[model samples]
Target: MTTTTQERPTGTTTEHVDVLIVGAGISGIGAAHHLKERFPGRSFVILDALDARGGTWWTHRYPGVRSDSDLFTFGYRFKPWRGASIATSEEILSYLDEVIADDGLAERIRYRHRVTTASWSSAEHRWTVEGTREDTGESVRLTTDFLWMCQGYYDHDRPYRPQWPGLDRFGGAVVHPQQWPADLETTGKRVVVIGSGATAATLVPALADTAAHVTMLQRSPTFFFARPKTHELAETLRALDVPDDWTHEILRRAYIAEGDEITRMSFEQPDELRELLIESMRPQLPEGFDIDKHFNPSYRPWQQRLALLPDGDMFTAIREGKASVVTDTVDTFTETGIRTSSGEELAADVVVTATGFDLSVFGGVSFAVDGQPVDFPSRVTWRGLMISGVPNMAYVFGYFRASWTLRADLVSEFVCRLLARMQERGATTVVPTLRPQDADMPLRPWAVPENFNSGYVMRSADRMFKQGDREPWIHLREYAEERTALPALDLDDDSLVYR
Candidate 1:
């Protein structure tokens, strides 16, 4: 939320700006636009650690790196994605490029400028943001009334490769999915994909047709399901030859509604959702495949990430004998390949380690309040945007299953409202207290979170910005709920302490 104090504390100078946004991801871009609407005259800038914009999308230039969520919900609210329901990586990249260019925000975003640390000064009523240019190793700093961190969670934009026991024993070239070598060859080689999350699921299927044999190794079973490719509502609209924008909105709304409906059933007891998923999956299995052990997951639906189709998804690859799932943890890495707990050594020429991403807070930057370390993990968030203790800063988090743009769109609206209100009141800055003596706030995760994927969920819930447990504080995934919540603009903040 954009809020500044009317009184700028004595003794502050250099680059006097109203807001300083860190990270040029979608969230940061969205914040800039809203801030413009709220206070057009104020000086603001978005700094990126990398030399380009688009945050994760811009940074992650790996092979077959497309968004898992549908494109309709993924695009910004003000702007629309006028093409395919499921967009490709290149297409999504184009869309982002178009948005930035159209908005005339390319200049506002200083690429290769990364924020290293943010220290709030209560006496000065400003935040001192330190950044560096990785390429030139040049240091730059900014002091602004408010700071916003739209940088995403993944700390290691590089990849997470564990020291597998006897890993050096394997003479084969190992590759992390994050940093897939473009020039390296993987064709006709036996490939083993370690780790069983969305990344692993997408990576395995995409490689099956080319690789001699692709084996998926998992420590435990994770929920696997299909993302419906085309909806009936979308098809009908397309038959009418409606404009892409009109059809996109229709499909976006339908997907969101359907996704929320299905996701709400994610936590049902006795695993009803899991049972139904299994029942549907059983029909597609080969005649002799074990139903309970091979496919059936011990965890409930959404406990693990629901895998999507890289190329017609998991079933087609399995049915065609291009891919296989093995439920065993890796004991160690051998020169030849991986050694499983079952004492089975899989032969591999190329090993693709699709192990997950590293978790980071504020994009791996130190968060300080009044020059004191702001332990966000211990703070309860207000409206999933602002922390209770840190008054003016907002961390951008996206939806779990729904279109990330949906939540981001709402955040834009709320931030605009906050800025307008502050401007009207002549408030130059504001900071919320992270420590609430009266509130007993349980910690939570941020991102497209589901209770099912405990591994991923466990990492995100507590450290990321979270929703308030009470009515407006809770982030509602439903389309209708979000429709009302976002763009509402009226934040009743009896609890928000403004200085």
Candidate 2:
């Protein structure tokens, strides 16, 4: 919230920083905390595109949005999650603010600063990051010894949209969920929600309560189930005199293990579990409702993300005639309404395009070395954190398995170890190995992409690391196991050699 407003020196090496964090989100903020704790004398600055500091938690100001996971595991290890399970977006933001206040990170953050392009300087052994301020249009360039990219995978510029054949001709108001117009009222209006993912599922039920009529349209279905909002064992463990942190770690592991088992057994033993899932839903569906159309997904479990509800009921809303799910593709957006492949034109006054997000390579920002473009795609992942060829840069990637904060926590802790290692060996820079492009690489769209930007990651597959058998990266799902496997506190990994 505060900064040293001295003019940055131009055409010369100005401020000297030990590390430059390119985000003010949970990951970047967490990284800064770790760095300060490990090396108090080291100078580091956390930059964010928006004026706020919570990153994605700051950007997504949508309604009915809350942590799908528990707050205990979703929050940072350095900070305790004092709230109950499944915190609202506002609660999460307030908690983030508290984290900032408690850690004295206000002065360390630079707001309204969006990084444009980052190029490394091989001669000076530093990264030259460029970003412009949204308010005054002033630009700031900073060179640092190390770079930490926690900006996430989505791009806010171009909202993710599928090739809806007639989007330009849609007469009714069409809105992407990412940029949901604040003032637009859906009250008593016929609203159609596209997609069956978390966004669509959550939006449909939430909107149905207010809208005159609500319909959820999806080309493919998801294995939807109502989940318990609270965990009894977790509650018991917390009250059993177990360390809050230890209980958090254990519960995190149990949840991850449970999800992994469910997913693993689905693929490893599909018929039995699939039947159980179907049996549970069959009794709840309405008489005229088709379960196969909305609940049956084309892909197997874990291929696409699953929707969660604590109350064990999203179907009740549909059963009550408040909402309806249609498993048909939106053939086109005609003048009057959305035309489905079944030739059914659902009349609507407003359309909520909860289609998905545009996947970008780290917030649609580019990287470079010595002012030259940093071709980061030509590298293989090392421990899913560092690349073999890129030096002194680490990316916090939380793919489908676990909660995002989990890996971000690990990355933050590992960054602390990395800084200590650099100091111990007297190394000015740490670069991961950037190998030549692998000809045989099978690119899969595994991680959630933020925007629809053209990038190598969009054209890739899950080569990073799997989460044993779950959604986000499998290995880092459990905090306890992750604590043991991540970067050593002493920076003792032999794989990390100082140049």
lDDT of 1 at 426: 74
Q: lDDT of model 2 at residue 318?
A: 82
**lDDT values, one for every candidate:** 0.70, 0.69
TM-score of 2: 0.85
Lowest summed lDDT across 10 adjacent residues in model 1 is found at 4-13
lDDT of 1 by residue, 1-499 (tens): 3323332344322354677888777788877877776577777888887777776776665556677777877877667667656666778778878877877777778888777888888788778877677888776667787777788767746556677788777899888866767787778989888877777767777778788988888777666666556656677877888887788777777777777766778754437787877777766767676667766777666655576663356677777798887888888887788889899988889888777776677787887877689787666666567776786777666665566677777777777677667667777665554335446655455443444345545655566556555543455355446668666645445555556
Backbone clashes in model 1? 35
Best-performing candidate as measured by lDDT: 1
